[model samples]
Target: TRHDFGSIPQGQVATAEITVRNTGQGALKIEAVSTSCGCTSARVEPTTIPPGGEGRLLIRYDSGLHPDSGPVRRYIYIASNDPDEPEVEVIITADVQEPTS
Candidate 1:
């Protein structure tokens, strides 16, 4: 599973795509996706993903609310049915840019 973020601007909305694949032979049920901060929001595509299949989770961060620092970091909490990896955490990082003249 990988989270890809395209180019984004400051004081704008940045989106992240969280992908999950059922590498195992069993079906995977995603309990939920939580965010570390309120400025960050997340939504899952399908609640369940079949074996050998994949699912997507969308996360958006309100960059406008974040401080105009170098980089903003956040985490995504994932709950799944995979035995070996029931729970997984993903990291998100973005460099906020200042408005130019």
Candidate 2:
């Protein structure tokens, strides 16, 4: 999955709310939520999701943690109990604009 914050001002925080669904026949348990950089953080609501149910993946990216004022990319990893795919990868991106004085 992928989420783009588009263009945002420097020294700002951007948020992305993603819907996570369990399409399998068994319960989906979210084991862990991690990010590639300290600039980003995320969490999953209700950790355990029933079959066909859905949850929310709330992510926050702070541009202040990242210095470069251009396109940037980060990652979010979600470990789950899915048989086919145990780990779900989310690519988060943003375009950071210079702050105006």
Candidate 3:
């Protein structure tokens, strides 16, 4: 899953949702969701997905903690039970800007 939040205010929090689909014939069990830093976090709902079904991954970014004024990129690691691909990487990006007053 990939998401671009465009531009966001410096002190605000940004959120994005990713969908995990089970395209394979077997069940998809999401073991964990992790992020690179504390400023970013992710959670998976309905972690066990049946074949042809989907699950939701909620990602939150604390832009206030990231005081940079340029493009920002974050990565999410998803651990699953898929034989072919046990782990997946999700990218989230945004531009942090000072609030216009």
Candidate 4:
């Protein structure tokens, strides 16, 4: 799934959860997950998901590092056994704002 987190204040910790499902007949394996910015971090569970199963990608943002108000985007790459859904890219987006000083 994709998300547009709107906006967050600076120095605030932001997080997003991306859930993926294996709707195919074979097992699903996630090769890697990449972020658009260094201030963002992500982690996946199991690294592999069974057929007809679901998995989650947890992403965290260090707003302290990326302190601004605008649009931001992050991407995650997933690799699976199913040819039809062998590779998938998930997106996360948000706007960061500076915390009132």
lDDT of 3 by residue, 19-92 (tens): 87889998899988899888899988898999999888899998999667778989999999999989999999
lDDT of 4: 0.74
Tens-place lDDT per residue, model 4, 1-101, is 57777788767778878777778777777777667678878877878888889888888877777546667777766565667766667777777775577
Better of 2 and 3 by TM-score: 2
Candidate 3 Cα misplacement greater than 4 A, ranges: none
In TM-score terms, candidate 4 sits at: 0.81
- Give all candidates' CA lDDT scores: 0.76, 0.96, 0.89, 0.74
Tens digit of per-residue lDDT, candidate 1, span 1-101: 33535345677888767676778887788887898988788866788888898887788888888667466778888887778987788877777777666
Model 2 CA RMSD to the hidden true structure, in angstroms: 0.6
Residue pairs whose backbone atoms clash in candidate 4 = 68-96
What does the lDDT come to for candidate 1? 0.76
* Candidate numbers, best TM-score first, in rank order: 2, 3, 1, 4
Q: Which candidate's lDDT is highest?
A: 2
CA lDDT, candidate 1, residue 1: 37
Considering summed lDDT, which 10 consecutive residues are worst modelled in model 2? 64-73
Residue 75 of model 1 has an lDDT of 82
Q: Candidate 2 residues 1-101, lDDT tens each?
A: 99999999999999989999999999999999999999999999989999999999999999998778999999999999888999999999999999999
Any residue pairs clashing in model 2, and if so which? none
